[model samples]
Target: MADTLQREHAGVIPGSRAAVSAAVDHLLERQDARGWWSGELETNVTMTSEHVLLLAFLGLPHDDIRDGAIRHLLGCQREDGSWGLYHDAPADLSTTIEAYVALRVLGLDGARPELSQARRAILEQGGVAHARVFTKIWLALFGAYPWEGVPSMPPELVWLPPRVPLNLYDFACWARGTIAPLLIVISRRPCRPLPFSLAELVLPGTEWRLRRVEASGPFAWADHLQKQYERLRIHPGRSAARRRLVKWIRARQEADGSWGGIQPPWVYSLIALHLEGMPLDHEVMRRGLTGLDRFAVEDDGGWRLQACMSPVWDTALAILALRRAGMPAHATPLRRAVEWLVDEQIVGGGDWQVRCAPGTEGGGWAFEFDNDIYPDVDDTAVVVLALLEAEQTDEVRNAVARAQRWVAAMRSSDGAWAAFDRDNVRQVVYSLPFADFGAMLDPPSEDVTAHAIEMFSALGVRPDAPLLAPAIAYLRGAQAPEGSWFGRWGVNHVYGTWCVVSALAPLHIDDRAVSCALAWTERVQNHDGGWGETCASYRDPSFAGVGSSTASQTAWAMLTLQAGGVGDGVAASSGARHLIDRQSAGTWEEPEHTGTGFPGDFYINYHLYRHVFPLMALARYASTDA
Candidate 1:
């Protein structure tokens, strides 16, 4: 394989082995004493700002936290005086609105220069009237936006069955968790007093109405009708529905006191429960608020909040990267990581079981420390692959068996996989007026399916196995004419192409598809001998595989080239050299948001991506026979 590919390109870059060793040391040094690895999961300023807002809504004394968050928000402001969804992106109206309001709530006067600039930017973007629905809801909580203008999500939505259209289950798990609590918030329409009015933030003559994104003719009308229904004071099933929603929300709270193990749902759940008369001192609210302390990260710069944590996901990937870098299963770090992962495996029922095949034994892993209710297939598949490289003791073997069975049973009707749910492909949820936030459906995505395929292949499943055949066809059909598969979870084409190519590499099938994808990866290689893609690619494909080179994305392309059996090829060598040249004291520094939450709407800078991925790429290069 190397001989043919070597002739097609060039040889591997020098110093790869030393670079791998340094990266290995860097990663191992960061491993927790508890036998796991995690990095700060950074989103945008919205997270920190929302933390302040949540604290304020609960009337909790948060002087210290508020001071830190204010500093963090100030630091995050761009030259034009706006906060964005990701680093170096254009100013987002909603993000700026939230940050500006958070600063106000934190005691920063509107006359402060930073707040003034942010105010100017908000006005330039059409002010509060143009912000997203969620942002408006946050404003409504403080009487800054009108509750009548916000989209309606009746708690009665819980009454709908799974078989019904536009039911609660139709929304993606993240969205579902958020919407469930939001139902109570909307119905209650609780408004706390703001010390200062946001009159300066709202555009004059603009009414508090839905923007284009929030208005979908019929859905908008339905929202209006729902408001009318509320005004009429109809009391049919309101109490019953609120009880069910409260029960639903409470049942899903993780051990860490977060609902769905995410910030949006967690914060909203606290507010919803509080509005429903749950006191802050109550166990549920106390745990919920106390758990948030874990998500808050304070550094020399300031304090910021992670949108979510990723221990299992990071540990699994760290294990894979170490194993690829020649760390034996017997090595202390590897052994400890494997043990932590085994202990972390969720063996109980979760929301995934709702749509999962009946009798699918429970054994999956979530990204967070306690998100047992939502163990995603992506993490589960990665965990299974990592465990395969371990010592495989009886415990490991049994855990892997159950996980593999759960994964197999979770396969979608089309024989592919989604991140969270199985066969969760309902599109009607997207048509709802309130669904403009982000993706509402957890449909099968190419990157996730690729991971599933790769996991099964690692377990000795043949390329032609009946179980994998349909999945292979799914990937083939999912390929774009230009040869890149869409990355549903990562940044863009580079991530998806890497996933598909690497997954199919061991199978030695799809030669033509692989060739086309290989050409695409090489064609997109940056002049710096690396690869990158902007979050904008999620909005427009022309930006795919095009941006300033980053450690993580460059690693994705390098791994793709190597996986296509061209580890010695010119493109692979260039990418390897790029990684080596960019290496610092031990690891690489990446500020780009390489991970996707809701694509264009939200992005993540998985702080560990800058470390683990580059090491994995460099190690594979050092070990390649080329």
Candidate 2:
């Protein structure tokens, strides 16, 4: 493998056994003594800002969190005076509107220079009147934006059956949990007056009747239809619909008193409980607040909140990286980590069971703690894949079997695997005026499908297995014209190509598409000998595999080339050198948010990826022949 390849492209390579060993040691140090690694899950300012708004909604007094949140928001504001979903991106209207309102709630006067600048930016960006549905609802709660400004989401949506299109189950678990509570909030639009109003933030002469200008696509009129439907709530069974919706909402709350571990659901659930007449001291309310507070992280720079937790998910990935780096499966830390994962399996029913075939045993994992009610296919597959790399005790094998069964059962009719539920491909839901965020449905994505396929392949599932055919077709059909696949969960084409090509390696497949993908990877190598794809790639495919080289993405490129059995040794060696040279004190400097939380809407900085991925890439290099 290396002889002819190394001769084709000569260059210095930095990867070594020592570098791999040091990387493995650093990862081990981060793991808890009991076994599990959890790095800080970082998000944008909106999380902390929403934290303040949630506190205000509950009538909580001023506290240091409020002060620290404001500081964090201020620190994140660009010179143009608006907050982007991620740092260094352009200003986003919804985020800026929410942050401005949060600052006002925290006592920033209208006369403050920063406030004035933010207000100017808001007006420049069309002001609060033009913000998204959720932002308008937040402002409406304060009697700042009118209730009529936001789209009406009737609680009656709760009545829709699972078999129907646009039903509650059609949405992903996060969106489902977040939107159901808003049904009550929308039913009886509660107002919590602030000492100040956003009068100065509103654009002059802007009408309170917000138009759905941004809503466009097939069923664009779904916006008008939704509003008309809201008016129909005045008919005979309206009260029944409302009550049933509340019952459904209350029933779905997780054991931790959260609807889901994510911030949107946690905050909205609290507001929904309040609207249901639950006092702040009520057990549900108290537990919900405790769960919310647990997500907060305060540093000397300031306070911020994670949108969700990912310890289990992080630990699983870390184990795989360690194993690839030559860490024995029976290593003490690896054994402990696998034990923790086995214990975390969802052994009972969840929202997934509503559509799952009867007798399909319950077993999967979620992205966060205690989110047992909604174990996602992505986490479950990754956990299974990691366990396959570990010593397969009976417990591990049983865990894998249940999870594999669940994934196969959850497979969409298109033969693709989605992150959340099965058969959840509802396109009409995307045309709603309230669904302006473009994440209305959890459709099958390449990265997710690739993970599952790789899991089957790694487990020695036969090439002729029933699962391989549709998946191969899906991957072939999903390949980009530029010869890459869109990475739904990671950065961009590089990550997707890596997953797809690697998974296909374990099975005999048409080599043409795989070759094209490898060629693209070869052409995109950075001048510094690594690979990178900007976060912007989520928006513009032109930027795919284009940006400052990073450790994780470089690893993806290296592994993909190595797995595809293409690319000269020079490309592989140079990529390895980049990762090795970048390593310092057993860690890589990666402040970039490499993880994707919500494709284009949100991004995450998973602090563990930099170390884990580089080690995996280098380890592959060490084991391969030249």
Candidate 3:
């Protein structure tokens, strides 16, 4: 594999395994005491800035982690003094408005020149009126915005049936878990308006009424349900219902105190509970707070919210990468990671089985800790792929076979695999009033399907098997006209194209389809030899193939090219050199976080991705013949 490829390129080529090992050691030192890693989970300026405020609210001194955060924020500010979804991205009114408010909470007064400049920027951007629906609702709670003008959220609707078209179960689990408590708070309509008018901070003549949506009137079935429930004021069995809801919420809260396994709504739910007079010392509050702390990864630099825990996910990927790098399957780090992956599997039935039964007992793993309600095929597939490379002790082989069976059961009728659910065919779930957020329902996405295909291939499952044909057809059908694939989990086209091409390589796919996909990737290669896609690509497909080069996406591209057995002398050597040149002083410099399981509205740049991927790509390329 190595002799046939050309080697000359621009980037520094890592000289030896010793250097790579040292680089890995340096990164391992940066891991938190808890055996996990995390970096920034990017959001709009307001959310990022408010995140800093939350740190302050939690008692970190201004000088603590504030300086770096402020620098990051300042770097991202628009020329108009407002902020946006990302640095170098266009100005977003809602994010800017929220960020402006957050800066005030951080003790920046409008009279201060820098603060004044930001205020002017916010006012020019249409102030709170142009902000997102969630931001306005937050303001209304603090009386900074009018409660009456905000949309209604009646708690009585909790009693709606799961089978009902508009009931809570129809919501994406993340949405349902987050919004359930928010409904309680919104129904109470608590108001503690700020002391000063925000007129100076808003655009002139901006009417609050213009931003308001009526609590009544039918649109979706959910909206009609909202109207019906609004008329009820309170449920006839209100006390019993409240107790049941609280018990249900508490029951689902992971060992770390979060519901639905992530940060955004967990924090919001905690605040809502706090506002409802749940004492900080109370068991529920304590559990939730401690859970937040558990997710917190600290360093001398500061702390970050892991969008979710990644031990099971990271360990699984690390094991696979090590095996691919030609490390012995029983290497100590590989063994430990394999053991962790095995232990993380869920034994009982979860929410996913409501659609298809994941046949094996102790079927698969979820992405977070203690989340037994859902076991995602994506994580499960990846875990199985990793275990397949481990030392085949009787226990290990059996575990791998069991995981394979579980993934087999998770295959959708159409041959694709969803993240958490099976055949989640209801697109209408996304049209609900609260569905303004990204990806509420778990439909089988392209990336997850690709992953499942790869896993089955690794397990030596024949292409003619019942499960393989549908998935292959789906993958081929899902390919875009330009040869790119739409990535639902990562950035738009680049990530999807990479995974699809790599997965298809192991299958006996049409050579034309494979070559076209490879050609598309080669065409989109950044001048820097990496690949990137902005989150906007999710909203507008035109932006799909564009963004700054990133380490993880670059690695994905390299892996795909290598797997497809395409990219002869010039392209292969060029891509490999690009990665080598980016390595700094024998270590790879981490770029802006780029591993995203969700794009645009939600972003996550897994910290480990920066280290693990570059190493895998460079090592694999170095060992290959050019």
Candidate 4:
């Protein structure tokens, strides 16, 4: 078995022990003194629930914080007694099942009425058979599902050439990192049955085979190619594949025991190692356990998943927003945040290079570790805006100038600004099955472009500035025929339209464009005084102007109107009132996850965004007559 594994990955260079040790050291050093490790900004109930599961597995007491989290979990349950990706999202069977399992582990009895409520929700939503592909894999590990139900994941595929049509590299970087260790586990197929059965929760007449086929369609080509190269259910070749996969996993394990500074891969890697007979005392196991500490954050309200780090992205934006909202440039909070931002700037390359390519020579910072591969225009632009808002000390001035030059260099030929690079013009790759992301292929989004325009315009780059014409053209082209623009990084059309109006406000673009955008926004304003659009908006333009009213969406709408000089005091004040009314004591209430930068497919509710934006909107509206 070991021999076959070695042959399968013969070309792979397993990391030297010395190199792995150094990587682990680097990861550990990055941990905050508070004994928590959090960098990946995962935005789902699964993240926080998993954190609780991990802590419980590590023997942490179920304290008040755990209770609070449990309550938070309970609060999100749908009428059907299930949970989903976001608060207001329709209940997803997969997330509901996982949350139910986690709650049961926390001492909730499945036979209890509340537990039965969740079980019933799961059953009604098509039960385990209807859950996601990953959920099935997890269930298989616990003998809740048959191993054969899962699609075969041959470890030998790791040796395929990068140029191969369905090679691992074809996957998004995050997907590849996660699927690596997962392949190892799938190859092993360890099943430890729970004491009870979930058969009662399974839907009537549901066929797991059909469910499997449906879920694999997005990556069916890769699965098919992998199967064609390797036979299934053959034990003779399995040992070698397992050993080779273990070696591959070991090589990529970051210094702190994380696979790639992300949770999905890190958790899978730890589980894989555990299955390999690596005891809890093993240095690898210890490192994996300790690595989770980096992600733990504790505040007065209790602990929650960070979704990811915010130093470069959050601090920069916070500084800039405060300045824009009239906070003094030299205020202590602004200065401290700026100092953190300036220090956090990446001076070298990062993983973004994989997408943008090396030698593109752009500038900006990423939101995570060793993320120097590409400097995002959004982060860079925000940093420039922040630095410009800081007191113009010689050091601050120098940093501002450097960031400005970098932003200028990253401008696309279309005269717009993309998130990471200037001319990443590979559209063909985006059509691949694995590219589930909506904006993964684009050069620039309206949200990011508008941000760039605002920054450049403020930097004294006028409407006639060389970079301005193409940007304006891109903005005009991006506007929907219905007059609204799509927001790639915010809620939906309202966010996009608001961003365009704000960007055009300083330029004093003719009222024709402004009126068009403003009219679209006013049209979409819900009777509830907030605005929202579902993830469906991304796929169907008809749904773009339609979503439930949400606090964050309301704030976005109000901010847009205020920034556009719309001067509808009644509307602005009413919207602000709605937002204020939604506040839970002063903190904005969590309304469905409106903060998602990626909707439907990948939902996120920035914990801070729920409060900060509404605060900004209310403060601004209250001060203005409008």
Q: Name the candidate that leads on lDDT.
A: 1
What's the lDDT of the predicted structure labeled candidate 1? Answer: 0.88
Error of 3 at 11 (Å): 15
Candidate 4, residue 97: CA error in Å?
1.5
Compared with the true structure, model 3 gives a TM-score of 0.88
Hey, what RMSD does candidate 3 come out at? 4.0
Each prediction's TM-score against the native?
0.97, 0.94, 0.88, 0.77
- Prediction 4 global C-alpha lDDT: 0.64
Window of ten residues with lowest summed lDDT in model 3:
3-12
lDDT, model 2 = 0.81
Tens digit of lDDT per residue, candidate 3, span 201-227?
556677755345533335544454555
Leading candidate by TM-score? 1
Q: Is candidate 1 or candidate 2 better by lDDT?
A: 1
lDDT of 2 at 22: 89
- Order of candidate numbers by TM-score, starting with the best: 1, 2, 3, 4
What candidate 2 gets wrong by more than 4 Å, as runs, is 1-15, 208-235, 566-568, 624-626
lDDT of 4 by residue, 148-175 (tens): 5566666776776655644555554456
User: Which segments of candidate 1 are over 4 A away from where they belong?
Assistant: 1-12, 208-214
TM-score for candidate 4: 0.77
